[model samples]
Target: MSQTVDDPEGRLVSMIMEANKYARFAAVCDKDGNILWNSHRNNVDNILTLDETKQSLRRAAETWKVRDTLAEKIGRGQYAIVGYEKIKRITVPLQNGHMLFVSIEGEKPEYIKDIMKIVDYVERNH
Candidate 1:
């Protein structure tokens, strides 16, 4: 039987970390870019300060707004990725109008495939 969850988003952040070895951080944020739950893998160093991270989330939310405007013609967006020198930031829209952010190590082409698998897992289990 399935177990009950008191904080699903927090649980989801933990699960996402377990699902991928390269995942450095995972967070669930509101449509307004407010983070509801988040987790960072132990021993991983965050390159951005807290303020920078918050700004990035807000920008991700704004980018989604633009995508929403185009959805009528191009269909809905699945996810967006921003590749930096050290890491790749991925943002996905949740069914409940929240956003999921995941950051993984950079410079690996295979990480994209891994992200696809994670997204599928989330769709099935979360």
Candidate 2:
């Protein structure tokens, strides 16, 4: 996929979608959980409705707020993972209070490494 120079966050989503075939959905949201950019793999159906997704992200943002309060004592959060039977959800904290939300297929443990590579990409480029 070609990336537009002006849209770094969009490019980030595109790059993430291409990073691994198992990647089902990728998104960048603000501290308030407003989705800035998002993409679902072609032919993949959404597992949640738009409103549901927004609400879910808002909850995640709230949790991150709590995490931030505890960061000084326990160190900053790198990422968080929640696995379900159908998919694995990974949330990575990004610069400027943005969050990267990614969902990949299946529950394979090894996929974490591949996802971490994506996290590394974000750190290096964004």
Tell me each candidate's TM-score. Answer: 0.85, 0.88
Please list the Cα RMSD from the true structure of every candidate, rounded to 1 decimal place.
3.7, 2.0
Model 2 lDDT per residue over 1-126, tens place: 324444656777787787678888888899999999888888888888989888978888888889999999999998888888998888888877888888888875467677667667766776
Among all windows of ten consecutive residues in candidate 1, which has the lowest summed lDDT? Answer: 1-10
Tens digit of lDDT per residue, candidate 1, span 23-117?
Answer: 88888899889988888778888889988999999999989988999989999888888888998898988777888898988875356566666
Taken over the whole model, the C-alpha lDDT of each candidate is: 0.79, 0.80
Q: In model 2, which runs have C-alpha deviations exceeding 4 angstroms?
A: 1-5
lDDT of 1 at 45: 86
- Whose TM-score is greatest here? 2
**Best-fitting candidate, measured by lDDT?**
2
